[model samples]
Structure formats: structure tokens, C-alpha cells
Target: MRAFDLAASAKAAAQAAVDAAAPDLVALSHRLHAHPELGFAEERACGWLGEQLTEHGFTVTAGVGELPTAFVAERGEGPLVLGICAEYDALPGIGHACGHNVIASAAVTAALALGAVADDLGVTVRVLGTPAEENGGGKVLMLERGVFAGVHAAMMVHPSPRERLDPTCLARAQLHVEYDGRAAHASACPEDGVNAADALTVAQVAIGLLRQHMTPDQRVHGITTTGGQVPNVIPEHTEADYYVRAATLAGVTDLEERVRDCFRAGAVATRSRLTLSSTSPAYSEFRHDPGLLAAYERNALVAGREFPTVTAEDDRQAGSTDMANVSLAIPSIQPLVSIDSGDVGLHQAEFAAYAARPAADRALLEGGLAMAWTCVDAALDEGLRARLLAGATAGG
Candidate 1:
């Protein structure tokens, strides 16, 4: 049958296309790792990725979605539109600690592989150069700006310590909590001064005690950015940033309210002014499409990648991602591709050092091929295509 032939041809071509581009993809990952850029400032990473897409006959658009570093490269005019996300942001000090270089290169390769068969499959392939995942929420902004309005389904693989079919990500909200008070000479006019540092200290202590009653899926962590200029004078101003995460967006709201109350208690006890605000939109919890996830698992297994059995403990340790916001808008999946960083967790120097290692390079090819095959499978399957289109229509 023509359908069987197209499926077999697409599967083989996807693997072959990624294999042919393996060297350049690995080199691109290394280049991105070597020159790490912060979120929304990934000029070089965005330009390099766009260059590759342009060379591959894609119409590249930089500075899309009102974000300068955000770009999208597109090809084909068919019915199905597949959005492949490429994240290239690095952490402040740990540079590439999350292996975004691996993510960017693999996503591009996957798009290129799909481009090879787009005409035969009557599909349109797109590679979205999403610029921020670490410090800025680029994807969230793009989602708000209608950048992904017409996208049917999205897929991007994250590099991690171990492979996962689909990750369990927590919803997170960023917060800024500050206190203001009067300052005076510590010894001479202690009664005239209201110690802002004391307010923060009280808040921290309250949070420490609050841990006792924390639910299994609730998490709150913060760092004091300012305490005092010197210990001799009473501190007048103090500020802190915190991230509140929970199993769902509603849970994030509930946890944030309780956490704010702890900080408010500090301000009340010290007679200091309380200021609280959210730094960005809360990143939502992810919901993976079952059809796409199943297709990805099959492709990954055939490409010599195996996933460890997922457990609740794994969910407890899962990190939050802005891709979760994109999932809320469209059918999306962010699968984890393993790197050989034993005992070295993400956002650490050790993990950054191994991001471009041999194992990581291997992961780049496997992940790209697996994703490309997944898309191919989806295109070739009638029921799956209809389901994704129906979802897109409803999402619209």
C-alpha cells in the first residue's frame, strides 16, 4: 500500500537526514555551549540557528513575537504545521548547565529531517527559536503574543541526566518580596530605627517552620538579595526573590498566598512596609498529548534509547519549565534525553562541563531522529493526524 511505503520511506529518511547532519549539529551544540548567552539575549545562538535553517531553504524570521531574540523558520504550505522548539539560553554562572545547546541542535535537526519529507507527507515544518527558559519566560510571552496561534502540535527534547518519555513538571511562580523601614545609628539611636533585616529574618524563620505542614507536592524556596550594607547601622531596606512551585497552577496560587502571609507576618511584627509582586506570569503545569507521547516512545526505543521506570520520587525532583505554558496553549511535549553526567545535577558546573561531551553528542543525534520519526509517524497515521487537527481547532 502507498501508506506503508510512505511510512517506511519517511522513517528511513528521517534517520538518514539526521545522520548526515550529525557532525554539524554536534559542532553547533559545542559552539553554543562555548558561548553561553542569557535568556532573551541569545543573539549569537539565535543567529547561528537561523543561519542553519536559512541554508536549508526555510524562510527565517528573526525578532518574532515581539521578542528580539525569538525567531521562527518555516517551510511547506500544507495542512499540518509542526512546531519544533529550540531553547538556547544558559544560566548566569553555570553556562549551559542545562544543556540547551543540545536542545537547540536536536530541535533544528528534527525540523530539518521533517523538512526532507514535508512535501511527500503534505506537512508544514517549523523550527521556533525560543530564546529564554532559565531567567526569562520567552515561550510564555510568545504564547501571549499569539506567536503559536496556528501551530498544530509542538515538540522539543530537553537534555537531562537520564531519559524520560515525558517529564512531570511543576507549575511555578516568581515573586519579589521587599521590606522598607527607618534606619538610624545602631548604638546611638537603636529605638529610632526599624530593622528591615529583622523583618526578612522573621519571614525566613516562619518559612522554615512552615515546611512542617507542606504538602507532598508543594515547594517554596527563596534567597535574600539584600540584608544590610553594614552591621553597624540598622538596615533600612531588604529584598528577596522566591519561586513557589506546586503540582498545578491553582496549587501554585494557594501556596503563594500562604507564603506571602509568612512574609506579611514579618512586616507586621517589625512595623515595616510590605511590598509583594510577581516577576512574570506563572508557568503552568504541562499536559502531554498521549498520541504524540506514544509515538515518541516507540521511536526512541527503536533508536537504542531506553527510559527508566518513572516514579513519584522522580516527579518530586522534577524541575519547572516555561514549556509548560506552551503546553497549556497547544498540544506539546518536552521529553528528556539523557547525558552521561553521573552524579552531576543540572545548573552545576560539573553538568556544564559535560554538556558537549561524547555522550551528549550521541544524545543529540538520537533525540533528533526520534522526534523526526515521531512526526513522520503522526503524519502517516490518519487517526493521529485527525486527532491533532481536532485538538488544534478546539485550542483555537
Candidate 2:
């Protein structure tokens, strides 16, 4: 039988610790929301989060995995190492629209709470300052470079419009396509110009048509970053960024090849030079640990967070994240913590406005506490701990 008494005691201690740090945690969330930074450029957010972790007695490593903005904070010397991921990178143009501010603060809160009883529970808590979830795949790079070498399991809570125990996280790849062609005045010597913009248009049209034959779960979306220098001049160079997503990494890779053909077709038709490159490593599908997810669901429910009934058809929360990459390597979970921004979805300017509100603050605290409590439960459950430890050893 599990040591219910010890778990209860440790949970109380964790709750008290989080409650004591509530004001500071909420402030941190608001501060990050106020100063939104883009992926791989989160200098201020990284420094501020590191400072908070340092103040709470974690050994903070400023840079890890060759990423200047990525860091790892650790506390305790227990046998089972638990990783709590913190994502502070904001979306470009939308600014904090994805609510990474809440993610970072909640991670800090979980780290502090777990730190309070780490020794008692025989659990070493690790807080990973993961950057570039919005663009560069920071966690994917870090995982490849051994930043998560000793972590037995990992988890993080992402802010959303509704509470979900396990959100649909797809495997995704970012592709940057560039086209180069001869430039000429629109009216003067127009025949001498090779329109790069036309190449881009052809590629887009192909992609649009390709969508019809694609599987229901597959997604292909992109934006034109550059079209032309001036309307009066034929475009000499054009560039676009695209994301191809599917149910699995292998599936995405296959889909990526087909997508590349579309871009190549554009070049063939317009006789423009085309260059294709990946901006970051492809993210993998999430594999959530059932035990951890169940523990978190119970804890979240007890914290007064409700998961409204919704069928998969009605749920539009399917998205891509670097956290999914981490989940593939370690037993992990990324639960969706609701900010109560009804009808205001993620990546919207209106959602950014709600990220710093009272509702979001409440979700931050509740999510953190649930994560901490789940950690306590994991530490107290000897069977789960042994399994995680065994997996870590085997993985090593």
C-alpha cells in the first residue's frame, strides 16, 4: 500500500510553500506577459526566470545545450529526478498570445513547492528553462544535447481556453523556402523579369490544392515574408515560411517531401532558383504517461479547475509544441490549464490581453499546485518511482 500519510504531509507542505509564494509567482507571470519576447530571443525572460529560481535555492545554469537563453535549475539530491518545463518565448506580432508567461511562472511555482519537501520525498526537482517553443524547437535541441540527461520524467502546463487532461500535440516541421529571380521594372523591360512572386504564388496554389488530398489530421500553413520590393518593379526575391504537421514524426517527414515537391513545382514553372531549408528540428508526437496524467487530473480537479465535457470533434485545441519532443524521450505530460478566455483562442491579441488578468493568475496558481501535488504523489508511490528510475537507467 502507498504511504498515504506521507503523501498527505508532503502535499500540505507543498501547498503551503506555493501559497506563500503566490504573490511573487503571479507578479512574475504579469511581468513576463508585459514584456513579451520572441523565441530564442528571450534574454529578459530567461534572466528573470533564472533569478527567481536562484532566489528559491535552485542551482541555476544560465546557458545549456548551446542555447544562450536555455537554462536548467536543480534542487535536492534525491534519487528520482523530476523535470518541470518552463516556456517563456512569446509569439511574434501577437506577443504573449500563447500564454507562455503563465507556463514559466507555473513552472517556477512547481519547482519552489517541490523544493520545499524534496529531501523528505526523495525527489530531485529540475526546472528546465526551455526557450523557442514558438519557433526554434529549444527543447528538441536541448534534449538532443543532454540537458535532460538525468530527468526521469517531465511535465508542463500550457495555458488554453479550456481544461484538458491530454491535449492533441502533433509532430511538426518548419520549412523556410526562398526564391530568387531576375528583377525588372514593371512596365519597362517586363519581359526580361523572372517573377519570384509568381513562383511563390504557384507554390501556394499547389499547397492549397494539395490540402484536398491530405489526411484529415495533416496541416500545412505558411505566410509570405517577402513578396516584392515595390509594386512597380518585378519581384527579384521572395521568401516564405511554412509548417507541415502530422500525427507522427515519420508521417510529417513523408508529408514534408510532398510539400517540397510543391515548392519545386513553383520554381520549375517560373524558372526561379529555389532554396529550401529547415529552421529547426522536427517536433515529435507527445506520449503522455498515464500515471502522471491521472494524478494531475485528480489534483487539478481538487484545485477547483473543471474540465468541461467536450467531444474530440468539438475540441479545437490540437496544436504543435517542442514539449512533445521531450515527451517522446521521457515519461511526460503537458496538461492544458484554462485561463477562462472563452471564445478567445490562443495566438489572438485578445487572448494576450487576458494572459495577465485575474483569471489567468488563478489558473497559474492552480496549475502549479496541481503539478506539485502530482510530484508528491509520484514520490510517495514507490512502484511508479521505481518504474521511472528503471526507465531512466535503461535510457542512459
Candidate 3:
């Protein structure tokens, strides 16, 4: 067989293997969806993923990077190290509404399928259990600790309302602001109190006005956690959480400085002491490697999946993810896999329900097979691999 024919055949075999593992994969996905854990607290999800990989003959190492929820599983050996990134952290209250269960299962399925033909493909497969993507920068921490050291390329499929090869994800910076003031009875001696709530109001108004000068793609929003204990008394202290995003990390840094200035202005305007802290490191923008994306798009099409053509308007509405940080370090793809969750958007209770439904199960299987085939194509096609490496290195 010619090289392309060999790759096609290997991909076919991998898809068949994934089909055979469909039942187990679906069950695992449902289990994870049913018991959603948030961010750094995904201990149960991490253990389950490690056990599944271990059972599938991959050497599993739990607690990677001193993180209780992080793990690394490896199989095969060769110069090309293919990384399958898995995320299991759910949203705080709505749970697996973002379909992390699908992500976790897809990674496992792809790793197993690729491992079955790793020897012939001449590549290594590593399944990385990266937690806390919703809040803490788990992958960023792992990257800093040398967890991804030798991986040639990394890949993961994120569940979304639509299927797309490359959706623009914004760089993000999270801020925590606290304002301190003096308390007094609301109706009595109100003049003696410095209102922290007034400080937050000032900051919010400034942010609203700042939006007029920002790029249309920029997003600045936040919630006040503690406006006041009671309406009868002035609030002695108030806190708020804000997330500011931009098209790139440098843009995010600049926007963040302006946001801090707004907070400082609020302090000055309200006579309250303001303190600002970053809750997490900034998440960078995603860098797309066209060669790798083309391979993935081909594999996805063969697996009966089609991605929609996204336009500038689509780019205007973007979300932030730590996966962007991974793209900066290595060749990575974070394509969206649709779950047919209706109008119920991510981080909603209804979407969480769909995450365990039959449609989601099908998405898990198809996404896994497609990602596995993409890896095979990458390893079997030398030109494409070199292009991906070059693109990643140049972008880095």
C-alpha cells in the first residue's frame, strides 16, 4: 500500500476499534457527567481516568506536578510524541455543562486506538489528565513543571454549540478586588460611614464607559460577591471578581492595567481602600497550525463530521480557555465537537443533562475516532508533521 493508503487503512482499523469500545466509552462519559467535580477538586474524575488508561495497558502516573487532580499516561515509543489532552473539571454549580465528560472520554478513546497501532505508526501516545481548566491553570502549571517536555504535538476536542476547526479563543486575566470602608447604621449616622458598595458601583460604571473605547472583541465583566451584609447597615467591606479578555496575551495585559486603573479610580472616588489580586495567570490566545488542522479536518470529514465555516462575527463571540496556553508551547488543536444540546448553552443545567444523553455519547465516539485518525495522519505524513512543528516553533 502507498503511504496515504496505509494511513487510511490504519485509520479505518482505529475507528473500528473505537467503535468496539463505544459501550465502555459511553458509560465512562456518563459516569463522569453524573458526578461532576469542579476545577482543582476533580479527584474522582482523575482517578477514574487513570484507572481506565491503566486498564488499557498505558503506564499511568497519578498526581503529576504535585497536583492531586493531574496525571500522565503513556504508551508506545518513538521520536514523534503525540499528546492527547483530557479535561474533567466542571463548572462550579452547573457541573459538566461544558461537556468535559465528553472531553475525558474522547482523550481516553483516542489514546487507546492510537496505542493499538503505535508500533506500526512509529509514534508515542501520551494521555494527559489536566485538571482545573475552569479556574486554576492546570496545564500551565504542568507545562511549567516540564510535563510536556518531548511531546511533538498535543490535541483535544472541546464541546461547543457548533462544530469548527478553529474557533478563536481570547486570552484571559481574572481579577479579585476587595474594598474596605467604615460601617455605620444606614438610616442613622450614615454620614460617618465610608461605603464600600459605592466603590464597586463606581468601578462598574467606569468599566461600562471604558467599553466604548475597547475593541469589539474585548470582554470585561464581573460580579460583586459582597455588596453589603444588610441594607440597614453600611458595608464595611466588599469584594468582586472580574474577568477581562482580549485577542492576545499582550492585549490582555494592557486591558488589565486599564481595569486596575478603573478600580483605583473607584477607590479614589469613594474614599475606600481598594486591593486587587490576580486569581490566575493569564491564558494566551490559541495559535493554529494550518497543516495540523487540515489533517484533523480531513479525518473528521471521513468520520462523518463537518465543521462550519466561521466568520468575523463568529470570532467576536469567543470564550477563554487555558488550552490556549498549551497551543503557545506546542502544536495543539482544540476543535469544537457539537453535542446537540439545543438552546441550552454551556454552564447551564439543561446542557449538563444533554452531556449524558445519547447524542453526547455519539459525539464522544466520533470525536475520539477523528482525533485518533488525525494523530495517525500526523505520524504517517512527514511533510505535515514538519510543517506543524515549524509553525509551532515559529509561533512560540
Candidate 4:
């Protein structure tokens, strides 16, 4: 059969498979949402996703990239390899607040659907059980360690308040700052202590002042993890975790240096020693493949998913992700699927509550089917397939 005819048949089979497995996928989403785990600590979520894929006849490899919670499940032996990313990490205080449960479930649904038609479509389907998206850059580490090697294309759907074909994904760097000083009794020897807390205060003030000079796309945000021990004792040690984000990796690097200088200013002014370190690998800006994104948009539209017109208010929805780093190396797209959360945005408790609701379940099913259809379209399009194959890198 010709590619187009095969694509039609495969798309039908893929959609049917997803429909049949909808209950299991929805259950997976709810289960993960109920048992949220932090980055690099998603043993249960990883095992559950791997088990589902294994039961569907995929070859599952756990701990592929030196990450205990990371796994890769593959089906088919065709030349065209497509990767589906599954992020399952929850936020510190908010369980699945970022809707990663939906992301993982949708990815699993897509993998199951595509696995059913992999041979007909002449494609290898991989469901990458990626962990630590909330804190550590698990995808970044995996990409560097060759977990994504030989993949021609990558795709995933993220749940949001609204649908978007190409939402802004900024490059980001996680910064861990530390300050050291000497502790002395506040009343007896106030002059002998070099206050580390005061040093952190100066750094925060500097960052606040620097914000006035920053561009709209640049962002610096963090929380003080440790400040002091007691009210009567001068702080001897302080630490904070901050994230610096910008339009690109180079921009983030530049902004990070400046932010480091802000921390340095704090140490210098307060006579405290300063130490700066990175929490994880830096994330790159997303480079959505034109052909893949267009295919996804068409499929999603056919599935009754609408992409609302971008407004000034929508610009604030931009966030950071390690998948953006994958996009730089592979033909990829991470489209946003709306769960009808209205004004409740991602990373909030209210949104987390909506992540397991009916709307999110619908998003999971539709998003997975749409992604599977998009893969079929790409696999059948000769020109697009050739382009994706040509762009494939060793670790892509």
C-alpha cells in the first residue's frame, strides 16, 4: 500500500486503540495524581508507566540514563523512531500541580496507540518515562547520557488552562547560592559576627534592583531555604535556590552571571563568603519543528481541540521545561492541551485539583490520540520523514 493509504489505516487503528484503552489511561492519570512524587524520586510512577508499556508488548528498560526513576520503553523496529516523553514529577508543596500526571498519562496513551500500528506505519515508538521535570532536569541528563539517541522525532502534550500550538518555552538555569560567616551572640558580640542572613538580604535587594533593568522575557525567582537558627545568634550560614530564565540558553547564561554577581554583592557588602552552584543541567529554549507542529495542530483541530488566539494576557503563560532542550536536538513539539481550567493557571493548588478532573481526563485521551495521529502523518509524509531522518543526531 502507498504511504497515504497506510497512514489512513494506521490513524484509524491508533485512534481505536486509544479509545479502547481510555479507561486504563484515565486510571493511570488518577493514580499518579493521588501519589505524587518529587523529581528523581518517582519510583512508583516510573514503575507503573513501565508496567503498562511492558504489558502492551514494548521492550522496557528501566534506569536507562543513570537515573533510577527514568525508563525507556520501545516497540517496533522501523527506521523512523519517534519519542514520547512522560513527565511525572510533582511540585514541592503542590502535588501534580503542574499537571505532570496528565502529561505522563497522555504520553502512555499515545505510546499504546502507536504501538498498535507501529508496523503498519513503519515507525519505532518509544515512551520515555522521564522523571524530575519539576526540579532536576531529568530529560537534560538523559539527553546528555544518550537516552534519546537515534530518535528522529519527539513529542508530548502538556495540560494547561488553554490550548496552544507553540507556547513560549524559555531556557532556564537552576542556581544554588550559599553564604558563610561567623556566628556571635546578638547582644554580647554583635560587631564580631558577619551576618550571612544580611548577606542574603543584600543579594535579594540587588536582584530586585536588577529586575528593573531586565527585559520582559527575563525572569529570576527563588526562595530562601535557610537563613538562621535563632533570634539571639547572628546567622553563620545561609542558602537559597533560584531559577534564572530567558529567551535562549545564551540569554539565560548571561542573566545567570549577572544574578551571581548580585549574590556576590551581598557577600562583599556583608563580609561573608559566597558560593554559587548549579542544581542541574541548563534547559534550552524550545525549537518546535514546523512540519510536526503543523501536523499536530491539524490533528488536534480535527479532534475538536481549539487553539485560542494569543493575547497579551496569554504571554504570561510561558514557562520553562527540559523538553525544550530536546527540541533543540530533535524534531519536537510540546503542545499545550487545555483542561478547561478557566483562569486557574499551572503550578497552583487550584490547577492541581483540576488536573484529575473530567476535563483533564478528556484532555488526556484527546491529546494522546492527536499525538498518535500526528506521528502517523509524519511517518507517511515522504518529504517530512526525509527531513526528520536527516536532522536526527546521535543523541537525538
lDDT of 3 by residue, 1-396 (tens): 688788978887897788887888888998998899988899899999898888888999988898888999999986688899999999877889889999999999898888888878888899999998988889999999999888888899988777888988999999999999999999989999999999999999999999999997688988888888789899989999999999999999999999999999989998999999988878999987666788889888888787777877667668988888998888888888888875667777888888888878888888888999999988888776675545455334
- Across residues 222-310, which tens digit of lDDT does each residue of candidate 1 receive? 88999889877999999999999999999999989989999999999999999999887788899887788989999999987889998
Query: Where does candidate 2 clash, by residue pair?
Result: none
Encode model 4's per-residue lDDT on 1-396: one tens digit a residue: 987688889988988898889999999999999999999999999999999999999999999899999999999988999999999999988898899999999999999989988987889999898889877899999999999999999999999999998889889999999999999999998999999999999999999999998999999999999999899999999999999999999999999999999999999999999999999899999998888999999999987799989887777668999999999888899999999999999889999999999999999999999999999998889888888888753233
Q: For residues 234-308, what per-residue lDDT tens digits would candidate 2 score against the true structure?
A: 999999999999989999999999999999999999999999999999999888889899899999898778988
Comparing 1 and 3 on lDDT, the stronger one: 1
In terms of lDDT, which candidate is stronger, 1 or 2? 2
Q: Who wins the lDDT comparison? A: 4
Model 3's C-alpha root-mean-square deviation from the true structure amounts to: 1.8
Q: Per-prediction TM-score, please?
A: 0.96, 0.97, 0.96, 0.97
Q: What lDDT score goes with residue 336 in model 2?
A: 91
State each model's CA lDDT, in order.
0.89, 0.91, 0.88, 0.92
lDDT value for model 3: 0.88
Candidate 4 lDDT (Cα, 0 to 1)? 0.92
Count of clashes, each model: 0, 0, 0, 0
Off by over 4 Å in 1: 392-396
Ranking by TM-score: 4, 2, 1, 3
